[model samples]
Target: MVVAAVLASGLLLAGPALRRRYPVAWWLLCGFPVVAFRVVHTWRPLMAGCGLAVSRRPALTVVSGLVGKGAPPPQPRVPRRGLIRPTAGGFVLLVRLLPGQVPEHFVKAAPAMAENWQVHAVRVTSWKPGIVRIVASAADPLTDPRIPKQRGPGHLLRVTVGALETGAAWVVDLRRIPHWLIVGATRSGKSTLINALVAGLAPQAVALVGIDCKGGMELSLYEPRLSALATNREQAVRLLAALVDLTLDRMTLCRVARVRNIWGLADKERPVPVVVIVDEIAELFLVASRSEKDEAHAAGTALIRLAQLGAALGVFLVVAGQRVGSDLGPGVTALRAQLGGRVCHRVADPGTAEMALGDLNPDALKAAQAIAPEQAGTAVLASGDGWERARSHLITEAEAEAVAAEYAHLTPVLSELHVEAL
Candidate 1:
């Protein structure tokens, strides 16, 4: 009895701490009692409170033959049927909708549900027939602290970038979405996200190319693994021209062989795949003087062409910047539109998030803009269907450099792949 009392007191003291430090796990652990209260109406204080919250209405007493003044009328409870399953950063509820209700109704009531559950937010997705999935969460997912790595390239040019809010590992297949645009403010773990990506690809047989407009201060660190590096506008222009030429060569080969894409050919006959990583993409498009405008236009044209035609030719792009706005240059808007994959981290302004994900989903724009500085590496990732809150694994610069150096031999030469047809 003494030990039980001590343990109870300790748990009572830890309640606030756990909710603040590890909300996701704590809520999941407490789910059993919460669910029980929803069903059984247990007598314990916590259980009783949860039961009251889920109940349709509270019993009212007649005072002076009338209801008490200032006593608000009870509201009907939402008819819910589901079980909670703990996920990586949250919990998923395989819920069944009530008659005349659709998933959109639940989506509209998500905020109210979040308030009742005391979670940060919730996302509603249709699971099947009459089933809906409610993903609820509080804490950041990157707190998992697991170092990110890929087993091997899968069905497509797949790479693991982070974990989705549903607690599942999220992979981005470049074959499906060939061009990606990543936006984040400084110190928002944008560099770490890039490092995780580079590390994931180090063991694969692919060419890693770079364009660092930051005077090579960034991409230069992985020089040992990069097949080509560009530090300035002049270098970027030349490198881009070469990439375009290679894409043209592959295009011709595909047409001549009557194959739709390079991947349709046998491995030995296929050209080497290339992944171009660009740091501070806006710098490559911005021109200060009339003397540089012509060069900038050409460089921009090359990048747009690569994004449009590279998906089938085995050329992929990962372009990142502190902020990407239409005012950057003449072709900036066009280039942004072509990038099918969008990752927005904690940005300095709502406008940056707007520019990144607004066209895809306006709701995603709000989610991306709301990311706090403390949640670095946590981003709003948007694709064709929808967006999800995800957290990228933290990989340090040194670790990325080491991985690059270890697999430097796997890097492919563009010239070898750009051979003239026999």
Candidate 2:
């Protein structure tokens, strides 16, 4: 005991003083007493003490769950009707609720259950009360082959995000949702995913336009397909006004046909869906203070109107940004209402992540941040259908170029009237 006490005292007294002077020697010396004490006694306390010391600093927690023996795994339970089997990182619940039985009931349950698990659900069947075949949650979104691989084979030539499974093929039936909100920190694969969407939709006959406030870096590569590219305040205003006009024309088309939604009508009668992709939304609000309020007001209102009514008129907006707080102004709040699909990547601040994903799945924000920087192409995706922690497929510049080359042959010749739709 005396020898142990003296050795520990020497370590405590000399370790810090010597560390900065000679880290190697200090570490070597520190290990002797540490190993000796651990050898003679249960090592838990010493390790715990060191951990507590380290935790005092401002760093991400290095330790995860306890390493000790844990409770025995739960006994395998028969899946109840409307409940699916839980996987390694998520739960799969089947629902027996019919289309109208309880729609929001499932949607509202996410924020409540998101604290413990990520959730996803797809309707399979509701023929019986105790038997629903819904896929509630998945460990990762990209892991499923059924979700979709691309929008179309030779379309959005650039795929900076997720892609179709290697052997599996599927197309996203966008008749489901009208608008999507994409958020991520810079270089977190936001633009990449958008490329994938474009590549997916490129083969389909659709009008493509882009509002790139940071010059045209994100969309300029596909200038051949982009009908219009907005780089600044004046251009954004013009571009949005053009979109409003197009929306009105489409509305006129819908009103004339007395149709509520495009999909509700015959495919031949429906107008081709127009997609608008906006990058760096914060720049719209980040103009000089001296800028005229009228311009800001016009821009804000146009975006909000698009967010609110564009969906029903066969217009979809894919808005991306770093932050969506009060810093960006009031327009974002209004726009949030219309964006039903949410995807979030890592953010520098938790508050930013919260703002982007809180409405859909609070847990997703943290999951997005938790994704390692090395895993750059991954993100957390949440939609009206369900939530999925997915890895956005890495669309390299080379791959985008390749896809663009292939789809160039299929690019539709834009009509003169389609010029304004850009």
Best by TM-score: 1
lDDT by residue (1-422, candidate 1, tens digit) is 99988866876788788866766556665543464344323222332333322333435443322454755554434445566566645566666765566777667767666666656667888888777887876544556634345666544457787787766677777777888999999999788788877777767777888889789898877888888888888878888888998899999999998999998998889987899999998788788898688888988899999999998999999999998887787587888888999999998877778888999988898888788888878898998878988888877778878887888888876653221310
lDDT of each: 0.76, 0.60
Q: The CA-based lDDT of model 1 is what?
A: 0.76
Give candidate 2 regions above 4 Å deviation.
1-173, 264-269, 409-422
**Runs of candidate 1 exceeding 4 Å displacement:** 1-89, 96-102, 118-120, 126-131, 144-156, 416-422
TM-score list, all predictions: 0.79, 0.62
How does candidate 2 score on lDDT? 0.60
Q: What TM value does model 2 have?
A: 0.62
Cα RMSDs, all models: 6.3, 16.4
User: Which candidate has the top score in lDDT?
Assistant: 1
